[model samples]
Target: MADEVKLHGLAGSPFVCRVKIALKVKDIKYDFVVEDLINKSADLVKYNPVYKKVPVLVHNGNPISESLVIVEYIDDVWKGVSILPHDAYEKARVRFWAKVVDDKCLPALFKAIGSHAQEQAVAEAHEQLQFLENELKVKGSKFFGGDSINLVDISATFIAYWVGAAEEALRITLVTKDKFPKLKEWSDNYINCQAVKDVLPPREVLVGFFKSRFGKA
Candidate 1:
């Protein structure tokens, strides 16, 4: 591997987790660099100068930023397991949902868990959850990709793990079984999948982090 691959990430970041899961799914061997997000490392700043964010994929010293971009880049470069579908329409569909995950789901979930306007945030998040539940029902897929985890599923990693920890830390519930059964089932399946399970941050650690960041510990 002359072009050695390395990932700069923060362990507790769901965005970083997306890259980790993508790498695991593709079975790409890469070095992991843990970046202190609160006090970012020099390499992280240099590599992702635009964002100065975690989950920068450095391939042969070339850097790629943004989780979705990095995940797609990993898929494009590696040939282990395909995350995006082959057909043009199908790939577009996956990309559509992946954007929704970033634009809608991630933002709302973050707001719901940690925003000053808790009531409004929860309401918006609940609406988004209902939309997601309906999307799963319409697609009728076991996972977002039908048979296995894919790019969209990977994009929604926060809902699968971090959201629960956030809820626990804040003493509030959002994705309860009764309210969003289908979404709940999908989350359960997603987190338990081999690639995802192996890389998931510990729940306790996540809870502590969330509490310190947003809640009364």
Candidate 2:
């Protein structure tokens, strides 16, 4: 019998989009279980009891929680496409950058959007983004993975897509063409990729969603 795969996720979620992009890149056929985070769902709760979050990947009755973990799991299990690097050092570097995106960049980015200390938050976000800008400049590749999307690129999907929506909704700019040219170029190339484009939420939809949460600018 074939394995059954289902992704329980909320629309416009960058984390969820990460898993969706990974699955799309691997050409995995799976069912999408749209989750209402407000009410929550029994299956979502059952699948991920710890956090009770969306983006739980259920495969053949087993559940995997956390978006990055799920993406790694999919990459490990599936063939044909490679999300992580084959070399040990390169793979570790990719994982390191992915963690930086989640731990350092994401918090700063969101805090810049929502924190009361606007100046401090924005400054911190700029610092974090500068790290990425430097990495892109040093690598001199269209993507963190070089020539294609990889785990690092997947992890930074929020910067590529959601930042624009957040900027529009809040009438602020975090990433600018002149300020971080390499990062800006990377975002353009990443979002325009066929697989990435296929899984991304519509820009207007994301803007509307962000507006609803943060109030109109």
Candidate 1, residues 1-217, lDDT tens digits: the string is 4669999988888999999999999887889998887798889888888989888999997999999999999999988789998999999999999998888887898888778337888889888778778889998988988989989899999998988887887788878899888889999999999999999999999999888888764
What would the per-residue lDDT of candidate 2 be over residues 161-208, giving only the tens digit for each residue?
999888888788788999999988999999999999998989999889
The TM-score between candidate 1 and the true structure equals 0.95
**How do all models score by TM-score?**
0.95, 0.97
Root-mean-square deviation of candidate 2: 1.3
- lDDT of each structure? 0.88, 0.92
Worst 10 residues of 1 by lDDT: 110-119
TM-score of 2: 0.97
Where does model 2 exceed 4 Å of error?
none
Per lDDT, the best of the predicted structures is: 2
What count of clashes does model 2 give?
0
CA-only RMSD, every prediction? 1.5, 1.3
lDDT, residue 181, candidate 1 = 88
Query: For model 2, what is the alpha-carbon lDDT of residue 161?
Result: 90
